[model samples]
Each structure stands twice: as C-alpha cells, then as structure tokens.
Target: MDKEQVKKLRAICRDISVLYVEDDISISAQLEKLLRKIFNNVEVEKNGLSGVQSYTKNRQDIVITDISMPVMDGIEMCKRIKLINSEQNILVTSAHNDAEYLVKLIDIGVDKFITKPIDMGSFLSNISKIAISIYREKRETVLESRIKAQQNLQKELLNGIIFPLAYFDEGEIVYANSSFKKQFFTEIDAGDFSRFRLGYLFENKKYVSMSNSELVQEISNSDDKTYLVMDVNKKIVKKYSISVTKFQNAKGCLLSFVNLNALNEEINRFSEQVDYFPKRESFSQALLEPKKSTKENYEIFCVGLKNTKGFIDKYGGAKMHSIFNSLAKSLKKEFSAEVQSKELSIYLFETNRYIFLVEKNLDNSAIDKRLSDFGKKYNYAFGSGLPLELSFIKENIKNTQSIGDILENTEGMLYTLSTI
Candidate 1:
C-alpha cells in the first residue's frame, strides 16, 4: 500500500482495539507489533481459551484467531462469543484449507478469513475494510441515539404546552397532546384517537361539509392563516379559537384550540348594556364636530374589553360595570382637555367599545408603546384580581370621512386582530 493509504488506514483503525490469538510465538510477535501500530489497543493470547477470557473482560472491535490452538480451538471460542453478542465481528486465520473447517467458521458468523502464511497485502486490505465498517457502525449508533433524544425532547415540549393541540399527517390524525385528549376524548377509550377526524371538532357546517382532501387543499391553497371560531358540544355548546399551521415540508399540519366561551358571553352582556346607555348620541355629536383645520392629521383607536364576560362571571357585572365606568372617568379626566384643544377625543360606541381620536402628529410607535404599558398598569391596579385585558386596534384618519366609514374601518381592524 502507498504511504498515504497506510496513513488513512491507520487513522480509521486508530480508535479500534483488537484481540489476536496465535499459538506460534514468532507470528504472534510480528502481528502484535503491526496491530499496535494501527490500533490504539492490541491484546495477544497464546490460546483460544485465554482469547475468550480477554474478550469477556474487555471487548474489542475486531477479533482475529487461528483455528488450530492447544486449548479451546478458535471455533469453540467464536461460538461462545457469538452467543454473548451475535453482532461481534470476527476474522479467522487457519493453515488448513479444509472445506469443512472453513464452512464451520462461516456458519459461526466469521466476518473474514485468511489462509496460512498470510499475504501481507490481503491482510492489510481486509483490516482496512473491517476498520471502515466499525467506524460506520459507530456513526450509525450515535446518529440513532441523537434522533431518539430529539424525539423525546419534542414529546416533552408538546406535552408541556397548555393548549389542546393535535397534529395531522395529510388527512389522518397522527398525534394529539395530553390536553387535547383530556378535552375532546374524555369519555372515549385512550388510543382510539384514530376514530376522530379534524373536521369533526368544528361547530359550523363549513368544515364538516368538506372532505379531508378538500379541507387540506383549501388550507394549502389559501393564505395559510388559521380559522378563528370553533364550536364544541358538551352539556351545552362552547366556543373556542382554533389556530392551524402547516408543517414546513407540507406533509402535515398542527391545530391548537383556546376556549373563548367566557369572553364571548362577556361581549354579549356588553351588547345588552347598549340599550341602557344613552351616551351614543352625545359621543357621535362630539366626534362629528368640525376640526380647526381640514389639513390637520389624526389617529383613530378602536378599543374593546378582552374576556370581559369571564371577569363579570367571576366578579359580578355590577362590579365590572363600576370598573368600566371608573376607567371611562379616568380617561375623560386625563384627556378631556386634549379633546377641547382639538388634540384628542374619546367616544363610547357600546358598553365595551371606545373610539379615541388623537392628534395625527403623535408618533404611532410611541402611542402604541404607551397604550400597551397603560393597559398593563390599569389591568394590574383596577382589574379586581382578574386579568380584565383589553384589545386596542388603531387606524389613521386621513380624510374628513363620515362617522360610518371610520367606524367600519375601525371594526374591520378589530376583527382582524381578534382572528390573529
């Protein structure tokens, strides 16, 4: 072999340990030197019995042995090794070219064979091949271990998520998280998830009317955004927000659900309060009053209570109404002067919705940051141990459009944010 070939062969064999059994002292000495040069560890045994003992103490990557030995022949030792580990790689060296002996070695699962008065060239070549196979096997084992670890981490992350979630492969339900199983399959036997389809969870006929293929096609062809509302039948109907996203390769998709029935009921109560409040006409008049200059800029904000019904249910509507009135009073106290100065105006649309018209010259980003911070502060201070979150959607009012157009665009933006 060329020097470069020898160098590469040694590099491949460097990490491997070898066990060699030979009764002849001269041959054993020569082979042991060569093996020590190529491998990190070399073990020599004068008999097959000693060889098997050495291997049992510390297994080697490769085993080479002569069939003719004084104690416990190579065949018998190899048979015992095979019983311990069927995948052990063994190389047999023998002086006899007897067909039966060679056949027996092969039956015992010897990896390679070399005849007596071994050819150095063939021996080196076989060693190189075996070394390469060992390296590949080690790599495959490491890769498999890494893959298993990643799978375990993914499973843990999925289980830790709070939302009910499911994964679909093409049209079939491949997996569901613990939350999903508990929420949707409580009465059904576990592992019977295969009986359910993704469409069966939705309330509207829109999803149920389409086949799985059709649904997949629709989701794939569209903007890839999720559907917002889902209905579930328990003792009573419940509403949830559903979010779906396709896998990167387009082979699968994941769905998650967030129950929003409490929030919906709160909004419904706010709608009912509309009949009791008579501030609509005054708020409209205030908003419709002409500005100082037609060239002046302004920003419009549409705000609504998030999950207000849940808050009211937990802390009665009378208390929630008082909180809302207090919030409105606070806003008026802070901004009524600005409204008089043509810099800002706050209008109440319904019990839950408010429109803020502010001077357009204000930095949009700064306003957003301020409002977000203010929302957090207000919720913490006056939320009565409930979240009492709020949603604020904004748009620029560039023209002297009618109140109808302004309200329409504001509601459109709110709807968009709700879906998101």
Candidate 2:
C-alpha cells in the first residue's frame, strides 16, 4: 500500500474494533501490539473457545483467527460466528496451503486468508480493502440508528401534545400519539392502519364531502384550512375538525384533531367549583375552634400531592376521590382516641393534599407512632403510588407562626421524603 492508502486505512481502523484468536503465545502478543496501534480497540484470546465466548459477550467489527487452536479449533469458532452473524468480517491465518482447507474456509464465510510466513505488503493492502468496506457499512448502520432515534423522539413529543395527533406517509397512518391511541386504537398497533387510507376510518359514520384520494392530496398540499373528519373512536363517533401540516423531509403530513364540543365540556367541568369537600372543609375548620379546657399549642403534619394533574391523569378522578376520602376517614378515626374531635382536623390543603392538625395536649410521640404504624402496615405500598409523602414532621403553630406557615414547612419536609 502507498503512504496515502496506509493513512486512509489507518484512519478507518482508528474507529473500528478487532478480535484476534490464536494458540501461539509469541504470535498472539506481537499481533496484539500491531492491532492495538491501528484499531481503536483490540481484544485477544489464547484459544478458540474463549474467543467465541469473548465475541458473544462483546462483538467487534472485525474478527481474525488462526486455523488451529486447543479446546476448540478455528473451524468450529468460524461456524458459530457465521451462525450468529453471517455477514461478519473475518480473516484467517494458516501455515498450510491445502486446497480443500481453503475451500472449507470460504464455505464458512472467511473473507481473506494469510499464509504463516505472511507478506507484509499483501496483508496491509487486503486488510485496507476490508477496512474501507467496514467504514462504509458502519456509516449506513449509524445513519439508520440515528433515523430510528429521531423517530422515537418525535413520538415522545407528539405524545406530550394534549390533543389527538397522527402522522401519515403516502396517505397511510404510520404514527399516532398517546391521546389518539387511548381514544381510538388502544389495543391496535399504529402500523395496522397503514394498509387502509385515512378515509377508510370514516366509513359507517359521519359523512364528509371529500373522497379518500382527494382528501389525501389536499392534506399533502396542507392549505392551512381545517377539514371535518369522523373521530371513529371504538363504536362512538365524535365530530373532530382536523388541521393538516405538511412535514419537511417527508412525503406526508401531520394531522391534529380538535373536538369543540369535548373542549367545551372540559371547560364546564373546571368552571364548577365545590363550596366544600362535603364534610372535609368543616372538619378542618372545626379544629381552629376554641377548646373549653386550656389554651394549647398546635402541631401540624401533612401529606401532599406531587403532580396533581399527573396523578389524576394516571389514576382517574374516581380513584383520586375514593383514596382521599378513605385516607381522611382513617386518620380521623386513628387520632380521635388520643385527641378531642374538635382538636383533630384532616384538612384539605392546596390541590387536594391532606394536612393533619392536632392540639399539643396529646404526646407528640403518640402521633408519630400512629403515622409510622400506618405507613409500615401498608408495607410502604400505600405510596407505591398515592399520597403519604407523609414523612410525618412536627411543625409547631405558635402565636407568631401562622397555620399556613407551619403547613408549608411540613409540605416541604414531605416533598424531601418523597424524593428520598
């Protein structure tokens, strides 16, 4: 090879890794040093068996092996590697120049063979050709992997969007967001929709003016106008106006759907406010009422909701209501024995969090014990998901410190415990 050829091959080998297997200790050591100088990574094995084991554990880009070794010969090793990856790049070295053996090596998918008294010029030139091939193949592999990664990132971003969204390629659906999946094809794969046009989804439902081919062409052009389509979700049909945007570097477009009626219904739900959480507000307020016995200090302990929206999204409103109601009822019953009904309050704090307040007449130790007991009795499974960021901290509500200040400090403590 010329100086330029050698430099080019070395540059390619600089990023490639190699695995060398041989029984000759002196030969193996010499080749190891040579391979290390050229390739980015070099792994050496004394025998064929360990070589196979090493390759299985950590695959390299190129493999070079001797024809004979102890425990397992190179023939069997080559066969095993070929079975694993038929396209594996391999070079074999042997002293014998037998025709039958050379034919066998070719059959086992060996790329090149070097004689025992190797000619340095021939070795460098042939190996350079293999390196060039490997470099080109690696670029293709890297390109494909990056494309897949980009697609995965796009899917994640689409899922974060609040409304139903889908992507089409050649007028066939290839990707759908989580909202679209839940609303329509929860059990079906996005690829299954690829065989049919987007208009196929509208059959047996709301009538639209455009034909499948016409709609597909219109969407490809994406004039920034909304088109009415049937949101065929399970057996129910909801009228959704879809906006299309042509995607750069793609032969298709992104479709976003908005159901005006559904949005209005959601708005109505948020508008209606609860005057009180049935009896919860009164219970918390009753604790602030003056006690007939003595003027006493108060101790507050709290459990908070981390992501209120996320919790409701995962567990639903019914489960949220049921668990909060149950937890409040349990806390009241547990602490009522030691403290007066008027002194114990399970208050509904910010964003549906619960704060337990009790007058300091009872032992603080007793309150801590009950809280710890409930946490353990549930095997911490109560918090596998739910409230009880309750690492019950004692915050004093003195003359100067407001109840809000006390609860805020406790909320901070609970947040730390939840993270830990």
Candidate 3:
C-alpha cells in the first residue's frame, strides 16, 4: 500500500477502536504491531473466547477474528457479539479462502473476509469502506437528536396557548404542527397548502394582488423583527389575527394566528377593569344621570397611580396598557347592548399616567373602586377623577406640559377645568 493510503487507513482506525483475535500467539503478536500503527487503541486476544471478553469489556467499534481457534470458533463468537449489538461490524480472517468458508461467514453476519496472509492493499480498502459506513450511521443518529430537540423547544414555546403556528419555505408550506394545521381548512394535503400562498385566504385583495416590486419594497422597509398582521377568513369564523414573523436563523416566516375577536374581548375587559374586580358598582349615588347623548364630543380624564416604584419607582405603563386592553374586553360584558350612546375609552398617558372617559352615569365611586382594586391587585398607589367635559379634553392629557402645571397649583376637579 502507498504511504498516503496507509496514513488515511491509520487515521480511520484510530477513530474506530477495534479488537483483534487469533489462535496463534506469534501471528497475533505480529498483527498487533500492524494494528497499533493504524489504530491508537487496539486490543488483541490469543483465542476466540478471550476475544469475546475483550470485545465485551471495551465495546469496541469493530471486531476482526480468525475462524479456526482452539476453544471457541469465530462463528460462535460472532453470533454472541451479534446478539448484543446486531448491527456490529465484523471481519473474519481465515487461511482457508474457500467459497464454503466465505458463505458461512456471510451467513454469520461477517462484514468482509480477509484470507491467507492478508493483502495490505485489500485490507486497507476494506477498512476504509467499513469506516465510512459506521461514520454515516453515527451521523444519522446525531441529526435525529438535533431535530427532536428543536421540536421539543417549539412545543415548549407554544405550550398552554391555543394559537396556531406554521412554517413555510419557498412559497410552500413545508411543515406545520397540529395546532397550526387545524387552523386552516380541515383535511388539507401538503399539495393544497403548497398551491395556495398565504394571500389566498386574506379578505384584503391588496395583499394578494401586490406586484413583485411592491413585495420587495415591503420586505426592504419591514423591520427584521416586525410581524405582519393578517386578517384571516376562517371557514367557521369570519376573521382572526394572523401574526407573521420571519425567522432570523431560518428561511421563510413563521405565522401565528390568534382569534382577534377573542383579543378584542380581552382588551375591553382589561381597560374596564372587569377581569379582576366584580362588576357590581356599589356607588353611594343613585344611577340618575341622563343616558349618554350623542353630540360629537371628546374628553380626557387623567388618573394617577403611584407605580410599582411606591411613589418612588415607575409603574409598567406600556405593559399596563397591554394588560388594560385585555381587561377592557372582559368589562364590556357588564354593559347592555343598548348602552352604546357613550362608550368607555382608555389610553396610556405619559409615564405613569392614564386617561379614562365614559358616560356620566358611571358613578365616580365605582370608577374609584375599580382603580383602587387595580392598585391593590398590582400593588401600587393611584388616584383618579370624574370624566372631563369636551372643552377640557386636551388639557387633561398627561404629557401636556400644562397638565403638571395645572395639577401643581389647582384643587380637586378644578385642576382639569377648561381654559377655553
């Protein structure tokens, strides 16, 4: 064998960890030297019985044994090893290079037969083949493990949530979990999702009819971290919110569809503070105010709450708005369907400030109770006022530089009075 070929075979052998077995101690000793040069770790056995012991102890990568031994033959030893690991790689070395011997070895699961004084060239070639096969098998195992890890991570991310998440590639749906697949039409084949792009199901035709130039521009202008809000027309339901986010490490975007109706309802309750507090408003005053009348008008009522800072730290304002939106949806159920003349509204103002506006009949005490409950639930200090008139809406805005100035100098209710 050429020196380069020997060197390559030796490298493979070093990585393989092998066991060598022969009945003749002198022959086995000579073979051990050759094996040592090729493999960094090679264990040799004088007899088949001893070979099985070495093989079991080291659990070597591959085994090579002579068939004619004193106590145990190669076939019997091979069968024992195979019973432990059926896919074991084995080679039989024999002086009798007959077809009958080769057939028998093959039946006993011998990977290859090396006869007589082994040809160094043939030995090198056969070892290379076996090395490649084992490497491929191990590689497949690692790849499968990685895929399973990714699937588990996806499951954990979406746990306890009912939203549908899907993945697509090159204008076709490649894979989707059970939740995501169920969001679309039932009994869909891969071919169906592939044929239909995301735009097919959206009510807005603009998304479907966009030109390639427009698409490119949108992608360029889009924030790498942003999501697309899609309105889906479901078979059973009319519409839902579909959030599409492109994976930073992968091709194609991941789409998560959440029912918008459900979200809206949540927002209403959170904004109205009906989620955590009872809706029964035990106001000291009778509900005698006229039903809200419609005259194009707007109002802004400032509410104060010592944020989580305990009058020292700031409340989580932006996040609070998010939660408030959820609360408002739950609160809407408190109102009758006919009570639509004047609607309750909520907004997050600058810093720890909040603005609320609703019909006058909503007792001030009821609003205070809700605000107090919110403060206690979240553990913060807060204060609120009655709804303001149309003329004073702008002044009551939290960030209005004048708002601080007005509150700093004025008394209750008077602080929000209109200058106009």
Q: How would you order the candidates by lDDT, starting with the best?
A: 1, 2, 3
Question: Per-residue lDDT for 1-420 in model 3, tens only?
Answer: 778977777765566788888877777877778778877878888777888888888888879899889789888899888877888899888898677767777777776888868876777677678877776777788899999999888767764456766666655666666666555534444447655455545455666775423443454455652333343324544345545677687767666676666677667655555333232121101112222223323233554432223223234544455434433443344333313544554433322233455444555455556555543454212232222112112222232234344344323333343222
Which residue runs of candidate 1 sit more than 4 Å off their true CA positions?
186-189, 216-237, 261-420
- Ten consecutive residues with minimal summed lDDT in candidate 2? 270-279
User: How well does candidate 2 score on lDDT at residue 94?
Assistant: 82
lDDT of 2 by residue, 43-109 (tens): 9998889989999988888888998899998989999998888989898988988898888888888
Q: List the residue pairs that clash in candidate 2.
A: none
Clashes of each: 1, 0, 21
Q: At residue 326, what lDDT does model 1 achieve? A: 55
The C-alpha stretches of model 3 lying farther than 4 A from their native spots are 1-7, 56-58, 151-162, 167-174, 178-238, 242-258, 262-420
For each candidate in turn, the TM-score is 0.58, 0.58, 0.48
| Candidate 1 residue pairs that clash | 266-309
Residue 369 local lDDT, model 2: 86
Q: TM-score of model 3 relative to the true fold? A: 0.48
Identify the runs in model 2 with alpha carbons over 4 angstroms from their true place.
1-11, 21-32, 43-60, 66-85, 181-209, 216-231, 234-239, 272-315, 318-349, 353-420
lDDT of 3: 0.58
Alpha carbon lDDT of each predicted model: 0.74, 0.68, 0.58
